[model samples]
Target chain A: MHELGIVFEIQKRLLAFAAGNGLSPASIASVVVEVGEASTVIPKYLLECWPAAMDGTDMEDATLEVEVIVAQVQCKKCGTVYPYLEHDKICPSCGAWECRMVTGQEFNIKEILVYEEDVPEDGSLGGDPAVR
Target chain B: MVKVYEIKQRVLANNDSEADALRSELKQERKFLLNLMSSPGSGKTSVLMKTIALLKDDLKIGVMEADIDSAVDAQTIATTGAKVVQLHTGGMCHLDAGMTRQGLEALDTDGLDLAILENVGNLVCPAEFDTGAVKNAMILSVPEGDDKPLKYPLMFTICSVLLINKIDVLPYFDFDLDLCIGRVKELNPDITVIPVSAKTGEGIDEWAAWLKNEVTAWRDTSSSETIIAKNKEYDK
Candidate 1:
């Protein structure tokens, strides 16, 4: 499926971002993605692809969250904005085809949450000095 | 003693930017790329062949054929004597702008007139990506049923031209022409619908003539020095 390729792209971007930010292995907690209704991406398919894509990687345990953005458009004739239904690209209220898309048609990873290892009070990078 | 902040960045933004660049490049080349979409047995290949045959004498035609594996369609069109490139998607269901740019690089765009890309046979995924094409054209065969416009409204709505393929099969099939046109118009009144049979070469002259006119008009508009200057700036 095309989802596999998309998953690969996502992993590539995620790794690039994590490496750029000096994040270590196993630091990522979750990845939040926003998908638009017009996009062909199926959330269920992307979720199914997550494990295979992240396997043996730092993001192995990271959670994947997908948010759907409903299609919305602005009418040129009536100056009204409304949610698009039935995949119709026209403004429903005014029957205008020159409407601009206000929302939807999005496919992006919005955020990545990571947790750093707790620091030791004794200024040692390895562990707690009190226990040692 | 230290604090860390979460930062969010869009992963696909880079790809979108690349696609935008490719779109501008196409505009600068003064080429109107049409991404033709349809199902496997939808006569897309034949229609393209007919189109090339009719317009090759007058226009500098180029074609990019996308397939999951084989280059059969490209081979078939080679007979038409157009500049054809075969793109093997490997497994992808759709052709994106990046792939299109890659394909175009392999083509001779210097003094080229029109470039037509035949997308992998699938209605859903192909409709999602913009392949830097000036217009999106879709072919719907008769056996696929007249209700397809209502079911797959996105493909019809986004398309500028809708070619009703396999018209010669109308005698055997129960495809209601009136209902098909009605539903497509209901979804997108601005879309130009042309009915034809690529097999028998029936109604193909009109289709080719319309295509030639559209491309000629685009070429005329793009050939102006002012438009060329603006296009170069847009590409940069």
Candidate 2:
């Protein structure tokens, strides 16, 4: 349910981008998002929220792509980087409990690809270029 | 003609950047904030109420209560006479750093000695977001059972302090204290575990004392004019 807020934000951003770029609301092809394992954001849940969020927006046809990143932490004492699994808090190599996370725990929309309607020789925008 | 385009953007990174700014700001104030996490019935509110009752007169305290719905907890804390703010997440299961920053802005921290943020009740989502808190503390109520540490290892592992609440019910329930603590330690050896029963007020003093010492240490470190000056300079 909370994912809806995030999905709304994503939709808002995509729409604003499309409007700013002089692209029609329906021109958006897809939205790419990056999520970190530590972020606690379920990819499937976020994807399921995309359509409802885009319902009345120009990006209704846009596809959502989610990339999950694993969180990696570096041991302060041993200088070893290890995956920070929920079950294992200690460094496998040195048994160090103190460590810094290097990766994962990311939630961001990386890109939105929008296809603009081609302008005709008369300097007017044409509809569905394929029809010509 | 055909068109192909690729653009790279990080969506959630924006929130992280803002959170980083808030973290720096809190650190500059020389305040060590603790973000307490737990499930709805995990005894977070009880522990906080008891803690405030014990330390309110001695330490300048501030609290931020986050909940998906209701200002009930905030109203409850106001009776304790501590500086407090109630944040309604509306419907979000987690409270992010931006929300914490907004709450901090409304709080008067100049005279505050310690700030405790009671994060929205949840084990999964709250642990994922950083609220610019120095420590992440979690509570596991006895009724919730001893297997929580294993099932929700992420919450246990990320927490700096783990409180086993509702110990008074231990006799009534089959909760294995040693097993729970052992599992938590296995996942996070550095985590400090405290068994408490807020209902009976037993073991509340120890938790309160631990919190007092933590806040005192932070205050002592930040009390120096030299450090304060350095922090001011860093902020500029």
Worst 10 residues of 2 chain B by lDDT: B227-236
lDDT of model 2 at residue B53?
A: 91
Candidate 2 per-residue lDDT over residues B4-101, each given as its tens digit: 33444555445555666765566667676778999898888878889999998988889999987788989888888898898888888887777888
TM-score of chain A of each: 0.76, 0.80
The clash number for model 1 is: 0
TM-score of chain B of each: 0.86, 0.86
Candidate 2 lDDT over residue span A1-132, tens digit each = 468868876876766665555566677677778888866678989988888888876567888999888878888789999888863868898897666557775677665555545322453432223221
- lDDT measured at residue B14 in model 2 versus the true structure, 0 to 100: 50
Alpha carbon lDDT at B118, candidate 1: 93
How big an interface RMSD has model 1? Answer: 9.9
Question: What local lDDT score does residue B154 receive in model 2, on the 0 to 100 scale?
Answer: 71
